[model samples]
Structures are given as C-alpha cells and as structure tokens.
Target: MSKTVFITGTSSGIGRETALYFSENRWNVIATMRHPESRKTGLEGRKNIDVIHLDVLDPDSIQQAVTHALTTYGSIDAVVNNAGYAAFGPFEASTPEAVRRQFHTNVEGLMDVTRALIPVFRRQGHGTIVNVTSMAGRMTFPLYSLYNSTKWAVEGFSEAVAFELRPFNIKVKIIEPGIINTSFYDRSKDVLSTKEITAYDTLVEKIIRYEEGNIKKGKFSPPSVVARTIYKAATDGSWKLRYHTGKYSGTILGLRRVLPERTFIGMMRYLTLR
Candidate 1:
C-alpha cells in the first residue's frame, strides 16, 4: 500500500505546496484546512488527495481529521503541522488578545495536534512529525517578537520531544524556512498597532518597507523548496531532526552560531534599525 501523510493549513502557502508535492509524488495526502469546502473543486479531482476541514484552533476538528485520515488510508505515515500565521510589529503595541491568539494557533495548536496523533504513531510503532517552524525561531528580527517567540517554542519543543519519541520509533523534524515568497507577507500576517502610541511608527515603517522591497525583488525562495525539504524529512528513513530551507537560512543560522552574541545583535540592529 502507498504511504499516507496528514497535513494541516492546506488552504495556501507552504501547506498547499507540500500537499501538492506529495500528491504528485503518489503519496496519499490528507490536505486539511479551516475552509476545505472552498478547496473541493481544486483538489477533489486528485485521486490520492483528500481535502478536509481542520482548524488547529478547534480540538474537535483535529480529532475528526485524524480519525478520517486514518480510516481513509488505513495508515498515516506522517503528520505535517504547517498551519500557523505571524503576528508582527512592535511587542509593546500588541494587544493581550492578539498575543493569546498568536500562541493559541502557533504553539498550543501545534501541540494539540501532536498530542492527538502520538497514540496512533505509538500504536503503529513508527511515524514522523514534521513541524514547519521559521528561521526566526533561531534568530530574531525587529517587529516580529511574538511570531519569533512562537517559532522558538516550536523549535525547542520539537528538539526536546525528539529524544523522548526516539524509543517509540517516532521521529520529529523541524523545517526552518527563511523569507519564502508566499502570500504570507500580504495576507497571512497581522501587524500590531497601538493607535495612540507613535514612538515606534517610523522605525516599524522602515522595517516593513525593507521587507516588502526584498520580497518584491524575488529574493525569497518559493514554497516548493520547503515542501521538497519536508518530503525529504518524511521519506529519509533517518533520525535526523532539523531541515533548514530557503535563501540565507543556513548562512544566517551559521553566523548566529559562530558569532559573539553582542556582535550578532549589533549587526542586526545596524542592518534593520539603522
């Protein structure tokens, strides 16, 4: 029987790309999203792909999607937790609700999904959990404190969990992508704002403008690169845990590892805030 993979956040971006890649490669794909109805026509024609409703924020949906996928394919070889968005801008301006929601979706939601599927993985005695974190998880940038925090959480969580899951024949992998050219910049990001506080306005504007310029220049890699990396993580049949993708992901991470803490911080401030 062909292997099956269950993925979340397939409405667009990395998740959509991953689903398509796996499907084209002949793996059965459980492509899930909050609005699966909207995707019916597009993915329904594909024999090996099943589009289903699964909002990470909804525990019921999580259980439902997992159950359906297992029954449909008889086995789930992997689960890709790729459903997350960013809450950007200055931290001080971020609302309490926004902060909570950010963690709810990025950190807590991913945790819930993993928790729901571990039993199935244990029963089968083997499975893979691929988390789509970000380069920001390891390195910080201006105006993305909260989003960075969530990715860091995922990174730390995955790293620690890998050791525990090792004996269970389950593997955890983290995919870190840097500056991917997805709808993420325009549609999937939320910028925090304090209506009356203008202290960080000019600085935030400059940072946003700089990022937009980089994206417009096509400096970021396409989501397919990350999808390919994810596929490798799924099928590599090794205990490897981290896969970095997109442009400058390795270089930035390498520099951060080798450079002095103060030197790196100073360099980032000069490049972004200057």
Candidate 2:
C-alpha cells in the first residue's frame, strides 16, 4: 500500500515541490497552506494530492487540518512541518510583538502540528516528522538574530524530542537547508524597521548587498533540491537525525564544526562586514 505524508506551507517553494515530488512518487500528499483556494503551487487535480487550509499560527486550524488529512487519507505516515515565517534584522531592532510572532509561527506552530500527530503516529507504531530548519539554525548571520533564535530552538527541540520518541519508533528528522531560491528572499521576508536605530545601518546594508549579490549570481539552489532531500529523509527508513540540504549547507556546516568558534564567527563577519 502507498504511504501518506502530510505537509504544511504547500502554497509555494519547498513545501509545494515536496508535495509534488511525493505525489509523483506514488505517495498520498496532504498539501496544506493558509489559502488552498489560491492553488499557487498548482497541486489541484494532481494525482494523490489533497489541498488543505492550514495556518500554523492557529492551533484549531492545525488540529482541523490533521483531522481532515486523517479522515481523507485513512493514515498519515509522515508530516513535513514546513509552515514557518522568518524575521530578519538586528536583535535590538526587533519588537516584542515581532519576536512573539516569529517564535509563535516557527517554534510554537511547529510544535502544535507535531503534537497533533504524535498520538496518531503512536497508534500506527511508526511515523516521521520532518522539520525544515535552516543552516542559520547552527550558524549565525548578521541581521538574522530573530530568525536565528527560532531555527536554533527548532534544532534543540527536534533533538530532544528525537531521543524521547525513540522508544515509540517515531522519527524526528531535521532538514537544514542553505539559502534556496524561494520567496523567502522576497514575499516571505519580515525585515524589522530600523528607523529608530541607525547604528547598525551600515552593517545591515552591507550584509543585504552581499546577500543580494549571491542571489543575483544564482548561488542558491532551487526548492526541488530541498524537496528531494526531504523525500530521502522520509523514505530512506533510517533513524538519522539530520539531513543538510540545498547549496553550501554541508560546506558551511562542516567548516563551523571543525573550525574554532572565533574563527567561524570571524569568517562570517568577513563575508558580510565588508
């Protein structure tokens, strides 16, 4: 029998690609997003795909979507918690509300969705939880302190839960992707307003320019790269905890692991502080 996988944030990017990938590979896909009406990723009418409305910030909606998937698909074998937003700016420039929204969507929201599936998976005796974290989760960058906090929390959370869920045969898989060519650089951006603090302006501008240059040069990988990695994590049947995907993730993470802390930070500074 073909397995079923529930995915969030399917309106675009990695989530959409992953949904399509799984559907093409003969898996039932619950492709969910805030507005399923849009059909932006064009999953409608596709084989083995069900579009769902899910706002990660809404707990009720999370449960509702989970219920819908289970009722429609009969069983869910894996869930991809890809519904998250990013907030970028200096930490000092971040507002209380911004921080709350950031953590609520990326951290709390992911937790809520996962919590909903735990019981279902427990009943089934096996399941996979795939979290799409970033390379920033392990390594920091300028002007991404708020975003960094959420991803780091996810890494820690996933790691702790992975150990806890081992007895139940539940798997927690983390996907750490480097910058991918997604609206994350555009539509999904939540840049903190820096009008009050002019101190970090020069550094922030430098970093933005450096990043824009990379995007212009096509250095980032596409969403399909991440989708492929996610598919591997879900179907590979390994208890592996982390799968680094997308461009430059392995290189950057490997360097951070072997290099001294100060040296790694220095290298990061050199890249954007120019």
Which candidate ranks first by lDDT, i.e. highest?
A: 2
TM-score leader: 2
The global C-alpha lDDT for each of the candidates, from Candidate 1 onward, is 0.91, 0.92
Off by over 4 Å in 1: 39-41
lDDT of 1 by residue, 128-243 (tens): 99999998999999988999999999999999999999999999999999889887887889878657789988988889888978877888999999999999999999899888
Pick out the ten consecutive residues of candidate 2 with the lowest summed lDDT.
Answer: 38-47
Kindly report which residue pairs in candidate 1 clash with one another: none
Question: How displaced is residue 151 in candidate 2, in Å?
Answer: 0.4
TM-scores, one per candidate: 0.97, 0.98
Off by over 4 Å in 2: none
lDDT tens digits, residues 195-243, model 2? 9999989988898898899998999999999999999999999999999
